[model samples]
Target chain A: MAEPGREIPKPTPETQHFWDGCKQGELLLQTCKSCDHTYFPPRPFCPDCGHREVAVVKATGRARLFSYIINHLPTPGFEVPFAIAVVELDEGPRMMANILECEQTPEALVLDMPLEVTFQPVSDDISLPQFKPASQSTGSGSA
Target chain B: MGQKTVAIVGAAETTELGKIPHMSQIQLHADAALNALADAGLTIKDIDGVATAAHNPVELAHYLGITPTWADGTSVGGCSFMLHVRHAMAAIEAGLCTTVLITHGESGRSWVGRHGPSLFPSELQMQFERPFGVSRPPNMFTIPVLRYMKDHDLSVETLAMVSVIQREWAAKNPRASFKDPITVDDVLNSKMIAYPFRLLMCCLVTDGGGALILTKADRAKDFPTKPVYILGSGESVESPMISQMADFTSSRAFKVSGTKAFETSGISHADVDHLMIYDAFAHLPIYGLEDLGFVKPGEAGDFIAERNTAPGGTLPLNTNGGGLSYMHSGMYGMYALQEGVRQMRGIAPAQVEGAEISVVHGVGGMFSASGTIVLTNSE
Candidate 1:
């Protein structure tokens, strides 16, 4: 069934493990064995060298806020005045997530602020990797 | 290589813009194509090439009853029509076909028969972007503008000036959707769709389409309309995802394509008499100006704030009011190209008197793709 407000991702064959890892409150990143490069958003092979020999390693869930926007428009799944942020993980990849547990303003959501990943279970099989200020305690417990 | 010569002989927009409840998405394409054909004094049988974005070339060709020898359907986004013009020029130069008709139409506001591209479950956008609650273009595009503001010291007031300058041009255009003068405070205080972008700063939700007829420059005089010669053209795509942009401050695709167009045209910044940088959002023109080498990085805001791009200014930009005040039917490149043709032909409603050369640049996704075209009236 489709979620009401926000768009949900249906995990594919190549992406099932990543979603499963999220449900367990873990962040998985794909690393190329040949080039030793780490990448995000889950792919089948190494995007760096086109190598089939790839491995999924657990990330440290550590990142720094790169950029963000406080979207005031009313979206279906999310409330208005939410901070949609792009954070560069310490492992050398970037991804988008909601900067929860912080004021959705330019002052509070400072750039390069330390961040850590937290999972929000949207469905039985899906758990989204959301982020919050690293100074704050981990909010959501592992399912 | 010698100058590759191609000319746009005919250009026309859909009959009604802004609110056209009568036409479907495909019908807009047909409407523009037929209008262009009539403008060029040619029949459907005369066109040997067909190219379009948003709709299938096969569908448009069949609908117009033209069996083109060459067809190009390069849909990169709003700038897709610019790529179509480039491809059509190359095809005509290579003797693949002649008399190419490039069309664009979209029910962006009405959403009638608006069949969007189908992204599979495994697609990058579906897997990554959608999951993050990135609902639409407004939210997705603001991700970069906010960063740009921080890096460039661009205040919200400076950004609002972009719309103010464009509205100044729109006031001169009789057909402009929003001709009334708008102030910077008006723009800043409007409903905030996203951070730093207000309702006035965003492109208007409009329903319309436009078409262009192109042929070799040598044969351009044979057509009824004055040929707007294609001096140079370039198109490029940096990434499909906005988050994966090369940088937040600038668009790599805009730089790549704009540099190529300038180099091919062999014209300096001084030679440009007019300009049309697609203003889907206020920040786009800022990026377009900087990336296209017209202005230095972080200077576009002040350039507009100083009233340099308004009518009678040294550089007349978005003389058709741009997407901000003009009709924006989703794919805005076609309208940009049409304005270039109008200026070159000296027939623009907001005519920049004695204008000789015009540069039309466009952005596809949120700085994800770009296409640039250089047009001139001189042989």
Candidate 2:
């Protein structure tokens, strides 16, 4: 469900496939075919090796809390005291997202804690990628 | 130290800072420009080059009735003004223009003739980060500090000390927005704007602007005001997205910029008597100190805690009370440059006696961009 007043991302030609993957419950990443370099936020060319040939890969949806802040002020559609976090995907890229299913405190949102990606559909064309604590059954991979 | 020496012959802030509902943004720029012109005994007709950020240089030139042969509208973020000074120095050296005027103005608080946030849906920040509820600077800029603290074993009290010591400097400056003294407890107990960042740790939202006039060192003596020579300067950018910053604990942009400035200036850390690191947030100075090689990594918090940067300390920092207590009209790089000039001229309210060399460092956006300038009163 889309949160009222929250911004909806409009996809560009390069990022359309990534957004398309999100709508179908998959997190997509781009990898360079020439240099085998991986990157995010969807660009046509590889940033590392400047290669034109790239491949789209599925992210494991598993991540770890890298860093964050518990914002107390209210913004457009966000409730006060929410955790604005940066999570490191197991594949090596880090992205910003909001933490869910946890208390908005340093004690609860410990750094390096295990997390898993969960998509929240904000619009028909866009679905925001968020994170939540990894379940007990989800075996540890990296932290 | 180029072929031609460039010096700042005039520098002044707006007639009034904090709040000015009567003046629009461009008017604030004009007011500061006129004040600086009057200080240097020059006029708009005398200026052959112009530079500014946020607002277009062409618009500013037209607004001020200056038909400049050279103009720069390099707007990166808050540190845009620092880049302006660096660019102006090179322009003057290359004989691109005889005299250069760099102006900065923003309606951060009063919203006088200011545009609202223009968030493009296709922009990287808007597309990836904004949807996650990272709204304002306090939330975004403060995100990496916790990781820094955790790595350094820095306590919250040490972080609060940054606000406390800067407040002490602000107490000395009558023009500072908040003059009252504050304790570490006070900062800790203040309203929580973001985790690990209290209200006092954040910069003030005010409306103001400043301007600088630079000319060849040979013509610098013709001005009424003393000249502060630009010895060296450097600028660099890392990443626009805060999450993608090379490292959460330190800024890659700060390191590159500071290193280049030091290399160009050929000055050692011990030679610097005064420093001005843009304190948009408390952690910036800590990062600035380490990245600038003033101190080792993970030691800035303790260095600040031990009163190394306070009044009567070995090294003075943010002598203008900084953005935390001083006025912050969005782009804070102008104010930092203004204070550096003041220190060089021996006229700052909290002046460092016989301070010959001053280094001013600034950060734009969320550690996304950086610029450093080395200023000296001695030729």
Predicted structure with the largest DockQ when compared to the true one: 2
Fnat of each candidate: 0.78, 0.90
Please write out the lDDT profile of model 2 over residues A73-105, one tens digit for every residue. 888888888889999999999999998888888
Off by over 4 Å in 2: B1-4, B117-122
- Cα RMSD of all models vs. native, in order, equals 3.1, 1.5
The stretch of ten residues in a row with the least summed lDDT in candidate 1 chain A is A134-143
Best by lDDT: 2
The digit string of per-residue lDDT tens for model 1 on A15-98 reads 999999998999999999999989877887987789989999999898888888778877777777888888778887888888
lDDT of 1 by residue, B1-379 (tens): 2274899998999998988878889899889989999999989999999998868899999998999999998877899888988899899999999899999888988888778741112277777787777767788877888778878899999899999988888888888999999998899889988776789988998899899999989988998888789999889988777777868899999999999999999999999999999998998989999999999999999998888998778999999999999888777989999999999999999999988889999888777788999999887
Task: Give DockQ per model, in order.
Answer: 0.66, 0.87
